[model samples]
Target: MAVILRYVDNKSQVIERFMGVQYVIETTSSKLKESIDEFLKLHDLSYSNLRGQGYDGTSNMRALVALAKKNSDIGAFFTMTNSLVNVVGCSCKRRDALRDKQQENLMKAIENDCLETGQGLNQEISLKRAGDTRWNSHYDALISLITTFSSVVDMFDMIVEDCYNDSAELDDCFAEGNTELLICLARLSPNDSFVAFDKEKLVFLAQMYPKDFTDQDRSALQDQLDIYIHFVCSDNDFSQLRGINELAKKMVDKGLHRTFAYVYLLV
Candidate 1:
């Protein structure tokens, strides 16, 4: 987790500064508070004067921070957009197909005078998984989605068209799997527990704009983080991450605890 300290300095001017990041073995409310206390003690900072607390949606975390005396909010909007990106960008083959289709559409549009060539307008555009650190990431994703909607649908059609048996896919989209898939998608979004994947990334973005972090980034980070988590989950190399929690348990059972060497190398 990352910590930023905000306060009125000796001159009575308000100051907010980065206190650096720390890792915790577990994210339960109790462990997080202990980590914070340790961080404050290590840095010789006082926690008594903390005027408020800020975080993305997590009841336990809020309760943990409340010990420091605080208030909070949640984000669910960006979560939906991230979900859309995942639904479309599940594989590199699909992503490449989407880009190829996008270029074809762009060229056709230009030929028909539907789109004009300009400085940034005609440049190669790709589907960007949302990012909170990038300025106007939401805006860019919105524009891309609108422009590439047809391409996205076409690519998905092409991918599924080759499948000899698409009965399972059809079932998932239209029948018994529909409600379960919807609920699963909702749970995978930034508003749910999966936002934990991008916790530190969100913190960096949040710290970049502290005032806006409370106002906007708090909500936007969820969307970007959801996109990130989806991408990571979709990647083959990171496939093992899907079972990380269970793997940790197995490691514990095997007596292969996280040693200093193991943690150092992992970091």
Candidate 2:
């Protein structure tokens, strides 16, 4: 692996130097520390002098996975889903059974006129196995599970009738206060001609940040919002904007951001 050092010199300019690479048998934490220590010693530098560190994309993803696994429910769900994929895809016979079951269900639905038929619709899909290092794999696995749920239940019935006999229960992840806050926040969305905008909710949101906005600022914000909403709704340029990102850019391009500073800040 290679190392680089970045520091500010006496001239108040930033400098970065590429330190040579080191060969190591493993990339484990201990092995990497030893290699870095050797490099520091060779350069007459001390590890204690370092102030900050950086990680690459792979390292960041691994850290996210580790953090997410701390939630017991999330961790248990992933574990169960992984095991379910393995059990269902253990052999060719089981896989074939799953496919046949899906096909049978599709035919029944088609006959009952319960499903729409199109050239590109009703394609067969298999279960997706998630990976440890990539978080998106878990999402793909969950979608696959949803699509193949009925067939999976049939497979489980053939194998063990009493496995997972307990009824599944769902827990509410958000409380009432959080739900209200989320709704108020959603009222600020600029999508669909700013149809979600609510002047009262915006005022409530401003009131929450007492340190940033005082009673006078909140009072002025109400009038500013009235004019701001009128200006954006009637203006052709703002009407076509898709999301908050485009709205923000257009506001700057048209110099409206400064005109409605409080409104833009809330956005």
lDDT of 1 by residue, 131-179 (tens): 5443235457767777778887787688677563586677666775456
| lDDT (C-alpha, whole model) for all candidates | 0.57, 0.80
Model 2 per-residue lDDT tens digits across residues 1-267: 456677899999987665655656776878877888898899999978898865335775465566567768878988899999999899898899899998998899899999999999989989998777765677679888998898899988976743443322212334555687778777767788899999999899888778978999999899999999998889888777776778889999999889999888776
Per-model TM values vs. the true structure: 0.32, 0.39
Measured over all alpha carbons after superposition, the RMSD of each candidate to the real structure, in angstroms, is 31.0, 24.2
lDDT, residue 87, model 2? 94
Instruction: Please give the range of 10 consecutive residues that has the lowest summed lDDT in model 2.
Output: 164-173
**Superposed Cα RMSD, model 1:** 31.0
> What is the Cα-based TM-score of model 1?
0.32
Clashes of 1: 0
